[model samples]
Target: MVKQMEERHSIWLRIFHWTNMIAITLLVLTGFYIHAPESFRLFSNMDTPRMLHFAMAYVLVFGVIGRVYYAIVAKDAKNVLFNPIPDIKNLPSMMKYYLFLSDSHPDYGKYNPGQKMMYTGWLVMAICMIITGFILYNPNLFMGLGGSLGGLIAVRVIHYIINWLFVLSVLAHVYLDVSEGIPVLLSMFTGKIPKGFHDSAHTHDKSIGA
Candidate 1:
């Protein structure tokens, strides 16, 4: 069979994707260590992890900004951002397909409804994390914000909870991508996929459904 390829991710997107991935990974690790030094002895000293965590935080900040800018400039927001009415309507079909109760679902553009929801949620979560994080990092600077949110301790708790969400969601994201196939997983890195891969998969599923 002849293999044809198509662009699935742009160069700028791939850069942002990897940048965010690395920053998030480091942030999680360093975050855990910072949260419980005794429990998570990933690092021997607090200074190292604390410094690394703060550094990665800035990297993630820039990464998110760059990604959003690119999305708007490239008109790729529609491909990933969730549109409530239609996406909500399509969720049942997506859920059924994932549950193995159905073999095929109506096309959901670049991302399925669940994926769109998750990606959109991540964006929201990231923004929340940045806000809470800064409030904690510089309690003096964001004193008023922290006081409104119930102090630095509360902000810390919120940031920690969001970090856990990021960890769990990232695991789910990786699993779902790999489950789609190696091509789907590699597409992020290679920025290309076999042409008609998604279409062919859906067509086969439709045949099975029929």
Candidate 2:
């Protein structure tokens, strides 16, 4: 009898992943529209941009929270939220593997070392954005953060910067699916991966790195 494999990304992840794709794309479009193209105002003075930006911001914030919620409820949040903490010990080893030095460094199961690091960075950056956003949203309420406006501004800057990083990650993610010889796209949509690939991962084989 063949050892039956199970799906990793649940229905909720599929829903949120696609929903987030939509929200993030809209945010980018509305964000760029309002970003200093002075002659191309869609509302005579860019009033529409502000409304759209705020709306998308709300959606993104809520969507992120929902994703974290699902990750928690699904019991895989620990690995998804924060794994591979990227310590000094793993630093050299991870680099070696990336440089093709050694493929036996470690087996990261669902997310490899680099991906875990990215996820960690995303979580921290998202928290920073949320905090700074609150400050900017209601500076009056955050009494001690009067001088914290600079921090809020910093978060704004980082938020935009991370947007590209996020997009880049998405690109790399897609490219890996296509180039790495895997049906990652279909797995995402159908919540299924070839059992051989799944087995490779569970068995900690040399070809399981994703």
- Which pairs clash in the backbone of model 2? none
* Candidate 2 RMSD to the real structure: 4.5
Q: What is the C-alpha RMSD of each candidate to the true structure, in Å?
A: 2.4, 4.5
The most accurate candidate by TM-score is 1
Q: Give one digit per residue, the lDDT tens place, for model 2 in 25-133.
A: 6656666566554654544556676677677667778878998888777876666644435544566775776566764455555765566676767666656656655
* Model 1 RMSD, rounded to 1 decimal: 2.4
Query: On residues 91-130, what C-alpha lDDT tens digit does candidate 1 reach at each position?
Result: 8988888888877778888899999999999999999999
| CA lDDT scores, all candidates in order | 0.89, 0.64
lDDT of the structure predicted as candidate 2: 0.64
User: Candidate 1: deviation at residue 31, Å?
Assistant: 0.3
After the best TM-score superposition of candidate 2, give how far the Cα of residue 203 lies from its true spot, in angstroms. Answer: 12
lDDT of 2 at 176: 54
Number of clashing pairs, model 1?
0
